[model samples]
Target: MLRIHFTDADLASTRMARAPDALWEVAASLHRFQTRAGRWAYAGWYRTTHARLREQRLDRIVREVLLPLFPRARYFPDFLTPDQSSCADEGLDAALDAIVSTPSGRVGRELALLHGYVRVPAWVRRLTGRQERRDLVAAIRSYHEVAVRPFADQIHARLEAGRSSSCRELLDGGVQGMLAGLGPGMRWQHPVLQVRYPVDRDLHLGGRGIRLVPSYFCWGSPVSLADPGLPPVLIYPLLHEPIAAAPASPLTALLGRTRTTVLRVAASGAGATTGEIARAVGISPSSVSKHTGVLRGAGLLISSRHGGNVLHTLTPAGASMLRTDT
Candidate 1:
């Protein structure tokens, strides 16, 4: 069993040295979901949507990653099915055609794991709070040690056989190989994908993964803790929906005037406090909360507290609305 130790210095370096300048943001976003109610809601919401882009991401990643072995794939889904119910039947139908015409379950299983990993139901978000996270950490850590290490070995072997010679080279090459193959639908740019093991990691459920894989292929999918290399594993890159959310109601459309105000306040590169937002939007703190609540319910705004102040920010959706309006 291996343990990945982190010194305060090491963590600080990692935080400062995050690649793509985006990991910091992702880490913060995830931190927000660690709260009590936040985690519960996230756990419930992620399951409903993780497959939104799996079809699309898988189509691309699978075709690219395994295409060298098989080339008959065509008509792959343009987007993965995070929540099959959320997708249009037209795209879903085309996906089936491509799926049926494609090769058998072996390759399908590997690629499909990513989709299943993404569909982990935001269980990590369910930790009661710091105490639960601490209580669960030991089990999770053990699983990570035993489960992910084997997959890392497999990945390393694949990398060495696939390319360059050093340990760093192997890590980089393997990660690049996997990420490169993530396709257009990969939601997160720098997902922490790997195999994990958890004591309760489901055995009977679909793709009871012990492997830990993360990607921004779908920003909506929550971060999960599991080892994917173990039994009942699923393969396939599942990306989130393309995020082309359009509110049918005029009030819902164009970020609504109320939402627009809240988002604008949050934009100045600094998140807005409820008090600040209320003053900016000319409403009571309660009213500011009402509007923000609407935006949050829509997944367009996210709230956090910095020091003594509660802060609000336009999520990707809210940011997009502001940008699109301009």
Candidate 2:
């Protein structure tokens, strides 16, 4: 077992071990870090939430913690030399996912600050309103001349239980297999993907029962922003029911195209029929129905049938969207 302690007001790392208790403890500490960072991110970006922050935080931990610990004289001396890729490849997206997927706290915090800090230089450089991009990458080399690595038991346990076959499996299982593979004489095939050091000299090992792979957060590529192939970055909405009922406007992007039509159709005061709305908006009756459906979806309007004719009236959302001198 391993233990690291912290207070409510701060997040810091104080312990290390190559055992189950220790690795998981590191995980918990990192999770707290992620939670705290998430709060900051939420406050910084009004529309963001905790879940999204958690992923980024975890990524940072791997970017910083795991990479720094493996080399020195104290651990992993036996595994480096001949084989490389025994470690994680170095990149923001790769590092973040590697740690957070552990679903641990301590590791999460360490990772967030680590990645965030490294990214700072580049981010700062890119933001001066000057057109530019930043670059931050380092090579993955074995922390040779060392022995023993973090999470010895956790890694061994996973290997013993099976799950150590490929790089993808290890990444998918996360800490479970990575720790398991953290023996001696083993290295990673993808250095850019995560940390690689010699666990031993003969082979790549560890990885068993890993499940929670962290989501990808790449600031470099515009195409990656909404890529489904990227691990899912969930942002749990904090609202309990609609906050003050969506500001009395249900739609997020209907301002330019539909605003005028909406106002003209609803101007009769008593509201308008579907045909009347189509005439007013200069669109087909079916199109009016579609717009009405959207408005209704937004909690902005309501529709009712009077015999063969249907009437549409403004709800609070609709009225808010339709503002005139009267």
Clashes of each: 47, 61
True-structure lDDT of candidate 2:
0.33
Q: All candidates' TM-scores?
A: 0.24, 0.22
Report the C-alpha lDDT of model 2 over 71-135, residue by residue, as the tens digit.
Answer: 12212111111111112332223332332232334333433444443432233222222121111
Tens-digit lDDT track for model 1 on 1-326?
Answer: 11222233322322111111121122222232233433432342334323422533433332233222221121111112111211223332343233333334432443344344343223323232445334433332332233232233222222222121122332565433433343332222222322222222322223222222222221332222133232221122123221222355343464566666566666643366777666545678898888888888998889877587677777897777667652
Which 10-residue window of candidate 1 scores lowest in summed lDDT? 15-24
Q: How close is candidate 1 to the true structure, as a TM-score?
A: 0.24
Model 2, residue 235: distance off in Å is: 60
Q: Name the lDDT value of residue 211 in candidate 2.
A: 20
